[model samples]
Target: MSYWRWLWLALKMIYQLLCCSVSLILFCFNVFWLFCNLAIPWCTLTLLIVCIASKFVKLQRSPNEKRLLSLLSTPEDRPSYWAIANRAAGFDAPENSKAAIKKCLARGYRNVLLDAGLTSCGEIVLANPKRMNVAQQSLDELQKLNITEYHPMGSQYEPESMASLRQFAEFLDAEADQATVFLRLHDTSARMLDQLQKFMTTDEAFTQRTVVISRSPLAIYQLRKLKPEIICGLWHETFLSLAILKSSTLVTSIYGAILRNIIAPVIGISVVFLSKEEINLHIADLWRNVGVRPIVYMVNSPNEKRYFQKTMKIQYLTDSLRSEPHLLMKA
Candidate 1:
């Protein structure tokens, strides 16, 4: 056989191997999603499965696929918070449970947030082995910092009923001065948007003393139309600890979002909110700007918190950690 022919055959074999490896990886991810659904619904299942099977269909790559791949390969210096959340906390509610809250507080972070609906049976069983009202238990720890949890907007799949909101409202009404409510919006439809508007509008207290997470642009626009007292600007991406070291631009934007959307709404409007991450690579590096507080996370261990704080020079740290000084001991 000619030398050129042999080289061509070797290259073809390598290409086939690469393709097979990629296929196997996608297939395994599909199976893992199915397994996860055995416990909780993984909504992306159908889309993911279809994509996997369609690999055999050999359809020409659509523009959407090209765009998605481009986005995926955009060389994100910082990993997604969702990915880190899963890795650190097993995609379970334990990460947000009561013990986790206490641990996080002990780490010296004055402000924190939680997803109220994300609860763990372990927390219910262990924290209050007596099965105390877990909600109240959460409220107790939340009192320490400005905490907000979002109830998904659409179906009952992740829904917090109006009754739950009412209960939360009551909690806020009592501590209107000390604590503020952060409202999270889900992938909502037009009808859902209208209903949410009605709910917030009917109650002046709810509208005035609330921070919102508007997932969609329409949701943000609609909520503003209702003239809710405080509409948290959309935070499409949550700040992750890794992001601080990777891209200062990304971190600065997140800091600005928290200030404008999260902090300012809760504190007051006098606060000037700018795209901190977008403005420059570093707040100090670019201009002498103050009043910027950054959000950073610590997932694996308490010691990681100190490492992140020193490495990123983060002013704040969010973690599902217990208050143990030894936990944050030098990494």
Candidate 2:
């Protein structure tokens, strides 16, 4: 049978089991209450809790099953798959900021994207948190790597300041002709738009090669007007819920469709989902439907590393720690 068919059968079986079991329990309780033949004591509550816990145990995913799933639910590898790639490919900052980026460069990673945000601690120290450069040591490491493009990380879209906009424009101007700089806007503000417009019209870098991570349909419409080099879809955050999973024919379908149908083709854009587990069948199917690539994120474990490598079918694998000079030398 087709994959969809199997998915449908599985969903139906789960629904039936849930309904039948609940109905049987309710019927037994009602029958006993109606007869009033026995005294109900604390034992009854204890029994109910035990039965419910036992049911939950049966419903839990087994260890081997989880491992198998980790293997089978592989993500695709493609330029469009950067959402997952970024998390996997992130640098371990505390010990060495440049290590991960340098490793990516050595591994021939040309298209580089990063999550640029200030942590609570960073906010207290830096005046412009997002604009801070990599550590000198890290920058030195990056100097050794080949980088063609960089995308600024973001989620909200806020009005921009002319000064910040100019700073960004200048940063773009300083880069090579082939190099592109993309911004991820999280807040939707006219001031931000004004800044974007200034950068797009006046700045040679913005006019020639710049991209933005846009979420609002309205912002996308405005961005397309700029005639940017590329407009890709960006999923800033994803939180999974039971409602989303069961609502679909396949567990992955609901989310996949939102990104594909609702986010991509409409804007002539590509998309990135933040979490691997969150990129369910819904999102993958959506990618298949729209012919758009899907990406997953934030994978740090060794087991996850093996699973993504062997099963995720991801195009690019991003990981923390570019390289420990020691580890690389040892290798």
| Every model's TM-score | 0.36, 0.46
Q: How accurate is candidate 1 locally (lDDT)?
A: 0.38
Considering every candidate listed, which one attains the maximal TM-score? Answer: 2
Estimate candidate 2's alpha-carbon lDDT, on a 0 to 1 scale: 0.43
Per-residue error at 195 for model 2, in Å?
1.5
lDDT of 1 by residue, 245-273 (tens): 35676655655544444433332221121
Candidates in order: C-alpha RMSD to true structure:
19.0, 20.3
> Model 2, 135: alpha-carbon shift in Å?
24
lDDT of each prediction vs. the true structure?
Answer: 0.38, 0.43
In model 1, pairs of residues that clash are: 103-321, 103-322, 104-321, 252-276, 252-277, 253-277
Predicted candidate 2 versus true structure: per-residue lDDT over 246-321, tens digit per residue: 5766555545545445445545554444467665455466575664445555555555545654676543334552
Task: Give the range of the ten consecutive residues with the poorest summed lDDT in model 1.
Answer: 118-127
Off by over 4 Å in 2: 1-108, 114-182, 204-209, 215-217, 226-229, 242-259, 280-282, 302-306, 315-330
